[model samples]
Target: MTTENVDTLEFNPISAASRNGGYVALGTLGGKCVVLSNLSKNVVKLSPSDMKEMDLKTVCGADWCDDNYTYFHPKQEVMVFDLRRLATDIIRECQVKGVYVESYERKSGVWLMPDGGLAVNSRKLWRPDGTVLEHGIHAERIYSASGDIGFDLDTPAANDDEVQCVLNAFGGINWRNNLGAEMLLGWFGVAIASVAMRRRPHMLLTGAAGVGKSTALEMMKWLSGKLAYASTGPQTMAAFYQALAGTSRAVILDEFEADPSRRHSRDTLEIARMSYSLQEGDEGIVRGTPGGTARSYTFYSPFLAACINPAKFEPADVTRWVVLEAISRKPDAVALKEAEARVIGPRLARRFINRWANFQKNEAIVRKHIIDAGGDGRMADTVGVLLASYWTFVSALPATDSEAAKLVELLDIQDRIALHAITDEQRCLEAMMSKVLPFKFMDGIALVTRNLSIAEAIQRICDDPTGNLEITMRLAQLGMRVGCVQGTWRMFVANSPEHQELRKVFGGTKWASGGWSTVLRRLPGGTEGTQRIGAGFGAAKVTIFNMPADLLPANDGSALLAA
Candidate 1:
C-alpha cells in the first residue's frame, strides 16, 4: 500500500489503551493485528502477510516510531511467531476490546456504520441537533455480531408530506375497513421501532385468494427497506431462525402457516413464541451446537404473515398477533405499487430516525388511552407501541383534524376487541357445558338428552323430583351429584370411568391433565376449594367444581359452543 493510503488509516485507541495498561500485550483477534481504518471507516484486521506487503512505516501511522521497527519488524516472520506465542499465553486471561463488528448496528440511540461513521439513518450521518452531519467524527466503536444492518437510501430527499404520502398509499389497499388499514400503519410503525422497543407486536394479513395479501406484504417489504427479511411459503424453522438470529429486522412472510401437526410448522410457531418477550438476562431458546455446547438466541424481530386461512395458536400466542383482514377489491381500487413503496419506505425510515426520541416520550399517553378504553396490559404492549409510533410521526407534521380523529377510532375498535376476547378457561367451560354425559337407567337402558347442560340436568332433577325420577336414577349410576353450597349450586364429579369423556373437553386447556379444579376456580364466583355436596344421585360426598346455579343457561348438549 502507498504512504498516502496508509496515512488515512486510523490507529486503534482502544488497543493503545489496552497495551499501555498491560491487560493484553497485543490487542489481536483471531491471530491478526487489528486496527481502525479511517479510509474504509471500519475496524480492519491485518495479518503478518498483509503487514509485510504494505509500506510498514506508513501503515503504522501515528503508532510508528524508530524503536518499534528495531524490536518488532527486524525480521517479519519472527514478529509473527512472537505474536502467535503471546496470543497463546494471554488469550484466556485478557478481555480484548476492539470493534470486531462486520455489519451495521444501533447502540444507545445512535446508528453505527460499518465505515466507522455515526448515522442518523441508513443514508445520513448523525448530528445532535436533528441535522445531517457533513463530515462527522469516525470515533464510535461498537462490538456486536447482533446486526441491525442498513442499506443505501434510494428514495427522494425528505419532503414535508412524506409521512402523509406513505399513509395515504397504505390506505389504498383493499382492507376490510379503515381499522385494518390503520392497524397495518400502526404495525409498520412498530417495525420501524423494532430495534429499540422491548415488547414488539406481530402482524398477520388474512383474506380470500384474490384480496391482494401478497401486494400488501410487498409494500411492507419496501417500507421496511433494509430492516426487513422477506420470505415466502414453505419456510423451514432453521432458515427462519437464521434469518432473524442476531437482527431486530422485521420478517415479512407471505402465505405463512404454522400448523402444529407439521414439525417445521411447530418449530416456526415455537420461534415466534420465543420472540415475543425480551426476558431477563440471557434467557432465550437454546439449541445445541456441533461443538457440543449450546447457543442461546433471543429474537426481538417482529413478524408480518400473510395467509388465506388463519393459523390457530394457543390463546397466549394469539394475543401476540394483530390480524388484519383484507376485503374484495373494488373494481377501481388502485393497486399498491412496490415501486412507490421503495421510495416512501426510505422516507418513512428517515422520519422514524428523527422522531424516535419523541415517540418514546408519547408512550405514556398512548398507553393510558388504550387502558382507559378497556384494553388490557397485553394490548398496551401490543397496540400501544403501534399507536404511539404512528402518533409521533403525524404529530411531528401539521396533522389535520381527520387524521387525529381516525386515531381515536382505531383505539375504540381495539378496545372493543380486547373487551370481548374469550379467555381459555371460558372456552373450556363452554365445551364442557355442551357435552352430554350419558348414563344407563331403567334396568340397563341407556338414557341421553341433548336439551340440557350437566348443570341444568341436575337443576331439573332437583326442581321436579317425581317427574325426573328416571333422570335422577341414571345420574346416580354415573356417580354425578349436585346440590346447593352456601346458596350457590355445586356439582360433584366422581373420578369414575363413566366421567372420563369429560376430560377430553379440556384438551389444549390449562386443565388438560384433568386438573379442572385449578382453572375452574378462576371463573366468576368459583372457589378454589372443592365443595362436598349431597345430591339426588344418592348423597355421595365426591369432590368437583362449584358453579353458580345460573352460571350456564340450558343449552342443547350437542356441539361445542362458539367462542
Candidate 2:
C-alpha cells in the first residue's frame, strides 16, 4: 500500500521524507494528535478532511515546522487510516534513529545570544561589553507585539551621559518633588530588570492634560526599546494577558483610566493587584477559556499607566502602585527632546542589561537599607527596587562622598514619606467627612434639605447644650450621628443613607461595606462607642471618629460653618 502505489498516489511518503529533510515526529498537545517537524516552528494540527487529501506540503509545512519544505501532491482522495498508520510508522522510525533536530527555544526578554552576545529583543543584540551588534540575532523564539518596534541603539560606549537621557526625560514631567522624579527614574530600572526580579512593581503617572503624560509614555517606549508593550488607551485584561504572554516586556498603558464601577476596569485593576509579588509556587491569575478549561496567565512585567483622571482602587490595589502625580510644566523647566529619548532609551536599556549582575547585588543592599528605615515589606520592595536601580545606573559615575550620602539621604526621605503616606482608610474617612449634606432648621424637626454643611451641623449641635434635636435627628436618618463625647468631639457612623452615598464614591474599597466598625477603627483617633441621639434609639452601637483640631469646637462653633 506504500511503495506499490507511490507512483500513482497523490502523496508519496518517500518524496515527503526527502522534502522534510527526514526530520518529523508525532506529538500530542491538548489531547490532540499533532505533527511536530523541523520544517516549521510550531505544532501542526491537521483536520481529518486534510488527512483524506494526503496534503503532504500543507501537513508538513504547518506552523509546527521551523523551516519550509516543498512537497507536491495531487487532489486525489486517499485512504485516511492507512496514511495515518504510515505517518505514525515514519515518526516512530525518526524518533528511534534520532533524525529530528529541535530548535533551541528562548524566553522573550534580555537573554544571551548563541554568539555570547545579549539579545534584548527581536531586532537587537548587544555584545558582552554593552555595544550594539552590526546585525540583529534571533535571540528569542516567543511571539511578542513589542518585537515590531525594533531597538536602534548605536552607542559605542553605554556611559553615564548616554543614560542621562532617562533622567532628563523624566525631569520634564514637572514632578511634584524630587522624590517623584527619582521614583520615575527608579521605575526605569524596574523595567530594565523586570525579567530578573521576582517582584516587579507598577507605576501610575496621573495628572491633568498637557502635563506631559503622553510624553512620559513615549519616554517609557524609548527606555524599554523592544521590551515594552505601549498602548495609547485603556485595554481589557485579556489584551494585556495576550500581549504579555511568555514575555517580561513592560506594559505601558497611556490614558489608562480604571473606573472600578466598570467590569473591565475592575479586571484590569485585579491584574495589577496580582502582578505585584510573585510568590514561589504561585499559580497565576486563572481564567476560563472558550473550551471551559482554565488558562493561567503569569505577568512578570511591571505595569505602568498614565491618565488624567485617576481611578479609585482598593487598599490592596493602591499599595501595588507607586503613584506619581504630574504637574504643569514649570516656567523654568527644561523641555525634553524626542531625539534624545530615541537614542538614549536604548543606551540606558543596554547599560541596565550589561550591568544586571551588579544591579542585583546593589538591589539587595538597597532593599535592606529601605527596610531598616521603617518601610514595610511592600514599601521596601517598591521603593527599594527603584533606588537600587538608580544606584546601579549612577554607581559608575564619579561622585564625592557627599554625593553618595545625598543619594542615601534621598532614599531615607522617600522611605519616611512612604511610611507616613495617607492610607486608604484615612482617604475614605476624609472623603466621608467632606461629603456635604443639607440640614434645614424648622422648629424641633430638622428637614434634610439645604444651606448646611455636615461638619458644621455636627459642630453646631455638639457646641449647643440646648440639644439641637432636629439636626441630631437629621443625622440619624443619614446613617450617622455627631456630638461631643467628653471634651473630644466624635462622629458616629452606621449603615444607612450616608453609607450608601459614600459607597458610590468609594466603591471597591474597604469603606464600601457595612463593616464600618473594623475599617473606621483603623483611622487615626477612632474607636467603638454608643450614641443615643434620638428617642426610641437606645444607644445605637457605632464606629466613632474623633473630629480633628480643625473640626473641634471653634470659638463659637462657627469655624466650619464660615466656609
**Candidate 1 C-alpha lDDT tens digits along 1-563:** 01111122223222332112111112354445554332222334555566541333333332332322224456464442233433332332222433233222232223434542335433444442445543212443332212233433333334558666666656666675546665676677677656556677887788889877887788888877778888888677778667776556688888776565667555656777777776323447677766464556566677888998777766676778777778775565554477777767766666665666666666666666666666777777777677767777667743344544456565565544653376676665665565565532333364544445555566565554344666655555544555444544555554432344445544554554665555555666554333323343334324456655464334412111210
The best candidate in terms of TM-score: 1
Q: Give the TM-score of candidate 1.
A: 0.71
TM-score of 2: 0.64
In Å, residue 265's CA in model 2 sits off its true spot by 6.2
- C-alpha displacement of 374 in model 1, angstroms? 1.7
Off by over 4 Å in 1: 1-80, 95-160, 258-260, 279-281, 397-406, 418-420, 440-481, 491-502, 505-511, 530-563
Colliding pairs, model 1: 41-115
Clash totals in order: 1, 11
Q: Weakest 10 consecutive residues, lDDT, candidate 1?
A: 1-10
lDDT of 2 by residue, 133-212 (tens): 42211332221112333343454435877656567657766775456666777787787656557667888888888988
Give all TM-scores, in the order shown: 0.71, 0.64
- lDDT of every predicted structure (CA atoms): 0.55, 0.59
